[model samples]
Target: MEDLIEDKRQQTGEINLLDIECLGLINPRNTYAITILIYFLENSQDWSVRQEAARILGEIAFGNSEAINALLKVVRTTVHDELAASPDFTPNLESNSQIEFKQLLISSKILHNKPNLDFRASESLYKIDPGNQEAIKALINLSFWHISAWCTHDDAIELLKQIAIGKPEVILKLKKQLQSNNESVRGASAEIIVTVEPNNQEAINILIELLCNGGEILEETQDFFTGKRILEHIFKAIVNLPSPL
Candidate 1:
């Protein structure tokens, strides 16, 4: 496995597609494979290879502390890197008219800057530790910025719904996010809370508020499109409610 990874790195500056395909055929539980996978996950320059390694580790090393720690590290490092690259947005009295435009621009920058590695690692962490706080937090934060691109927002909310079941702390956090100043964050949180507790009046109310006041809340044209996407989620959640609002 090491030879294949190294050869691909030396030849193509990345693991070859065929080599990755072949590697996937190997037994995930092989101890030697785990060591090599972890090495590549941390050291490989190729993000796709690192992502695959993280995924395999999650599948094979269910209770392994070393594997869990590695996944956590990936989550932390990727998030940090992405945030550092995000465009800063600051509006002054003179620039008030540009606030909405800048918000849309910043959101676009963040969405494109995020790597798939963090999402993969977060998913792996959840696999190994069902209610891991870091994993849940990572997903929630990703949901807030990603919107509909790559289905990231939907996927994160789905996982959060799974984690929130029988987990009061997770539910509590979702409830708190309902009050987030960011419209996307509030929408994502409300979606999760409503999914978990269909009759959650607070969640339902927030969704309704977003639908009714989205244009006023998000003044820019592009931002309203974002709000429109959130409205789609809101309508879906409302439709799925066991009881009507």
Candidate 2:
């Protein structure tokens, strides 16, 4: 079967044979299938084939370090900004060729939006091991738009509480972002700070500063209140903080 695949590759210059092989190997119990997929991933000339191999690797590898390592190798080598000579590079191609091109396009968009394949790999790793700190930190390094929604949720609040206790430096990173010239960055930093440390004097002082000398405050409309009064939220947080001794 391996020789047949190599012969087909040499004749057709495509990975259709390997694609079929990968489909058969999707079962988690098939270790040899995983090994073959990793081989294709590492050595396939066509990146689209490599990408399909990556997806399957993420699925079947689960918590397997060997699988994770192969995927991470792909993640490291897969340049995100790679673009075809034309956006519509599928012209005059066979069905399999078109499929491969489409896969390449998907891979490009995934990397472009998420910033890197490593981030995607980390997400997959996290799915495999929820407590993987490396995965957690990798996800945390993503942009606010990528990693968080605008509104606070119970899970997010709980996570913040946990991070405050175990990894206070994660909270401190927000303080560094406060110095950013971008108002969105500054606003988000202040907002999360207040959420995490409502009683913290330093956080309160920063919020007060934002309220007094505002550039770009996050605006939210709650029950007919439509204004950029982030300071009010800060004030309310201060008011709600437990009274001092």
Roughly what TM-score does model 1 have, to 2 decimal places? 0.73
Worst 10 residues of 1 by lDDT: 84-93
How accurate locally, in lDDT, is each candidate? 0.72, 0.53
User: Would you estimate the TM-scores of all the predictions?
Assistant: 0.73, 0.41
For candidate 2, write residues 7-120 as lDDT tens digits: 777999864635544544544635665677778766665545665665566566667777777655533443333333235444445669668878777655544533444544
Q: Which candidate number has the best lDDT?
A: 1
Tell how far residue 25 is off in model 1, in angstroms.
8.4
Cα displacement (angstroms), candidate 1, residue 144, comes to 1.4
Candidate with top TM-score is 1
User: In candidate 1, how many Å is residue 180 off?
Assistant: 1.9
